[model samples]
Target: MILKRLIFALLIIFSFTSCTSDDDASTPDRRSIEDLETDFQALNLQQGINDVTLENLNGSSWNFRVIIPESASSTERPLVLTLHGAAGGDVDAHKNTACYAEPGFAALDPIIVSPNGGTQLWNSAFNQDLVIGLMYLTQKYLNVDRDRTVVTGYSNGGNGSWFYAEIYPEIFTASIPMASSYSTFSSNGSVRTIETPLYVIHGENDELFPLAETQEWVAATRDAGTNVTLEVAPGLTHYESCNYSPYLQNAASWLQDEVWD
Candidate 1:
């Protein structure tokens, strides 16, 4: 029995020593420039889109999906921001996106940001920190091409498209807000003064939002000194964005054509 107790005591001492050795030292996360550069080179961003989260002013968190195209290079690549509606959250809309989602993005590569609406509302109020939080989070990871930033959204997301674009016209090149309408002004309630390109799409048969909204958005943008294009899909309903099927395809193509410009 004595020998057994001694053996157990020895085992306990050895275990404690091993654990203490590990606890005695902690490594800092700081890395040298050369080390970081080496790590960056070893990293592969070609794994398609990724998931990211950010904290909001309300102490809540938001999720987003990022898609990077194979054609995208380290150079200034255009970034696409796709917003979701109130009923569906970020994940749902991210999956529904024609190109950034499944079989669509499996081939074509474009940087897409699908963010979760905190309250499912666009929160156009300049007081809200959502836009600033987004800009910070975006700059933190991916190298977004600011000069070519584009915003698009459906339903409530459409509000966000207009809110973000109008607020930061200098940061965005074009905006496509589908099936929705805004007051046609920047965040500060000032009329749009810059010349950001815009493409508006709406279904004439839309019941949730009148098809006339498409025309209204275009008119407002043009009147505000912004270049605008309008497309009204016939026989389409508000909830059913079937018309946007081709619209999304063209959106990708059109953006691709101008990414370099």
Candidate 2:
């Protein structure tokens, strides 16, 4: 009878051990923030543009340019995710002319990332997911100041900026959308109130997306209680993308002094 009791006790112990093992197998280990920062520092990324190709969360490949500032190692800097226009080829060239690369934006000492949108429009669900995944991955490896993150883009990329800021208000603090139309995302001429501030830059004589319509939409959005600012370039056209740099500098200044401050 003692042996029978011993066997029953062994069976119970075995069942308990099996259950513990099963629970352990189901739970995944999460690394601490300090550990993640240590891993990022270990990479020893150089100051300047680093061409990186990372696998997206969806198992697809994404090519992007990361511009690390000189003070990145010592200080936690703001992150700027700049998207290129629809004519997306050679992300490096796009980065060269974009406003974030200009001297004014550089003075902010922020880490800038320019991602290749490929042939697809940035407003599409697939590409939007890719943007979110990329931003998260960037945060995982870089010392990013979450409160000062900005999303800015041009033309089709501007459309993406608006869409992303609207959809993921918790991620971005401010948005600068240049040469874009609000009607692209909000077809019914309605603007959803979002917490992220918007600084829109558009050419006064935009041939493709009418400036008048954009002005109307901006007015309506302001009336709807969104913190928005619009800058109209006097004589610029939609295709003269390079000329928008000066305007972008103003937007960057506004972001640094007014919005982020």
Candidate 3:
């Protein structure tokens, strides 16, 4: 049953995810393509993304994707900011199946934002205020739960994934980093001891970085007595392993639908 489930999840991650881009479609979908362009212009409460111009502290103009949720009510939903891998700075990929966060996160409709690294690396690597700018924007435009904010990513973004979680543990309720090593504070591990909840995923058969790197990352948080969860996929490579839908399903299940009281 586990094997069958893994196969089904792999299929969804590869093909069955709900998001797609013109660059992703099997063929040129003129009608849906045109509709998408038109829809981007017409924004409703159903939630959409907005392009923002931001200048990092180092004077680099950072491109940002501010993803809103579907027609939500009562109060605004939580806010989650996603980072991308070194080669995958484009936000559209995150909005699509790869990151499993789109215009709509099914469980909880939070304000999701994805920031493009100015130079194939996070602003932190550039000694800038990009992340702080993100915090400012989150506070400025939305009424966040404060304790419910989340940071998640994979690979290069996975490095940034733990960066935010470590630096600002007070802001994030939970963090998930898939298929990336976690030592962000230089040669030493300073922020590894925060008490925030974390969900980590990786493949035992991953060839990118040894399983030890991921295990070390988790050990930091665990040694600090934080609420951390880790999952090791079997018989999968690094890229496709983290891309599996079941891993995303597990992540979404842990992250969404939490009451911030």
Candidate 4:
């Protein structure tokens, strides 16, 4: 009789422990925003570009560049994850390709991070998880305004912006994808309803990805109740990457005034 009673008690304890573990897994991080800001201030990071390498959850090392504005302080500032194009360049070259490290973006007073796309494109599962891990690491070391975090990219990176917004809506407040297409998600049948607002910028005369296709995708996404806007640049080509900076700056302004505000 005592053996049976002991077995029953063990089962009850195991059930309660399992329930507790499940609930704890679903609970949100209990750290306050102030605590995060304090931790960032402790870093004493200088105002300029810094090269950083962090290990992802999969034990792979990822290289990225961070641009800290002069105005950064203990107060939480907006974070912009600027993905680079898949042009087979190093992180330094990629950061400059899309004007992400330019003065224009710095004027917005947001901490910009540009990550190098590894052997695969940003839409790949490995790269996607790497991006997520980068964000988490950034949050750990920087005073990021979680409500105003943004994801923006150019060309291949632009496709990634859309992918992250669609797959991780809860992490980003908005996305700005420039000179990109919907091929990645559409081809994989991964298109779904996205709540994060999107500001898409594509050249009207884009030679690689047709402008019409982006318009069609935007229309479909809008019809599905997504807060999305498409801005077409006239006489702009795919290779005119630097020229897109002004348009991206405009989009950033819109995000500030419309979404973050």
Of the candidates shown, which would achieve the greatest lDDT relative to the real structure? 2
TM-score, every prediction: 0.66, 0.78, 0.68, 0.77
Q: What is the lDDT of residue 154 in candidate 1?
A: 78
Model 3 regions more than 4 Å off: 1-46, 55-59, 72-74, 87-99, 123-128, 184-192, 256-261
Candidate 2 local lDDT, 1-261, one digit each (tens): 322332343344334323444556566543333443354345456788777665433335567778888898998998888878875455554455344344537667898888787777886655665566556656656777877888988888888888878867777889999999875226665566757899999999999999998898778778788899999999999988778888888988998899999
User: Which pairs of residues collide in candidate 3?
Assistant: 46-70
Q: What ranges in model 2 sit over 4 Å off?
A: 1-44, 87-100, 184-191
Displacement of residue 178 (Cα, Å) in model 1 is 0.8
lDDT per model vs. reference: 0.57, 0.73, 0.59, 0.72
TM-score of 4: 0.77
Clashing pairs in 4: none
Tens-place lDDT per residue, model 1, 78-177, is 5667777664443545455653233322323547767666454675332123444444345444666665667778778776777666655555668777
What is candidate 3's lDDT per residue for 1-261, written digit by digit as tens?
A: 322332333233324222346445464432222332243334332356676554333324556677665543457577777776665445444443234555224466677777777455553533124554565545444555555677777677766776667765655667777777765234664734655677787878779878877787677657767677888867767777334456756677777543243
Predict model 3's lDDT versus the native: 0.59
Candidate 4 lDDT, tens digit per residue, 69-122? 766665787889888876575646445733543644555688887888866788
Q: Rank the candidates by TM-score, best first.
A: 2, 4, 3, 1
* Ranked by lDDT, top first: 2, 4, 3, 1
What C-alpha RMSD separates each model from the true structure? 16.0, 12.9, 14.6, 11.2
